[model samples]
Target: MPLSQSEVLAGLAEIVNDETGISADAVALEKSFVDDLDIDSISMMTIVVNAEDKFGVKIPDEEVKNLITVGDAVNFIVGAQG
Candidate 1:
């Protein structure tokens, strides 16, 4: 079954937290992975890979650039699931 936005966000938050030690609660939809979360490219890549595994979605390297915010990633995963 496909996951909800909130569900995806929550899971992503956990992945971010695990990778970067950032709090899950602080990972809101509007927050940018770079500017807001202070995440570097390497960390972002790790997060993306972990998210792909956790969500069972394949996020291509070309498309990773477009996922700027937490919401963007969540939306992509949701859409990919469908």
Candidate 2:
């Protein structure tokens, strides 16, 4: 079975937390990494790597800039996993 939206979001939270040293509780479904989490470019790349490894999906470099929120990351994972 494919992962659900919540599952994807949870996975993303785990990735972001592990990379940025931020607690998962600090992030929300609607949170923006830059505006809310204060994530820098390097941390964002860390998130990308973590997501890729966790989901077993390769996100193209060009699409990296497009992932701005938790929902965006979830959508990307769902699309790629399909």
Candidate 3:
């Protein structure tokens, strides 16, 4: 079955928390990765790589530039799944 947006977000929360030690609750849809989660460029790439593995999606290198927020990542993965 295809993943839902909520599922993608929930999984992303775990990935963010695991990588950055931030609270999963802090990874909301509107939260900015750098501002809210304090995710640096390296960590952002890590999240993308890990998300790709977990969700079976390929987040292109160029497109990774656009994933500024948690919602953006979720939307990308959900769209890729379709």
- Highest lDDT: which candidate? 1
Structural similarity to truth (TM-score) of each candidate: 0.97, 0.90, 0.95
Distance from true location, Cα of 29 in model 2, Å: 2.0
Instruction: Give the Cα error of residue 55 in candidate 2, in Å.
Output: 0.4
lDDT of 2 by residue, 1-82 (tens): 7798888888888888888888988767788879889999998988898888889899998998888887787888988995
lDDT of 3 by residue, 1-82 (tens): 9888898899999999999999999999999998887889998999899999999999999998898888999999999984
Candidates in order have lDDT scores of 0.95, 0.85, 0.91
Cα lDDT, model 2, residue 13: 86
Candidate 2 lDDT at 57 equals 90
The parts of candidate 2 lying over 4 Å away from their true place are none
The candidate scoring highest on TM-score is 1
Q: What C-alpha lDDT, on a 0 to 100 scale, does residue 58 get in candidate 3?
A: 96
By TM-score rank, best first, the candidates go 1, 3, 2
Error of 2 at 74 (Å): 1.0
lDDT (0-100) at residue 79 of candidate 1?
96
For candidate 2, the 10 contiguous residues with the lowest summed lDDT are 24-33
Decide which is better by lDDT, 1 or 3: 1
List pairs with backbone clashes in candidate 2. Answer: none
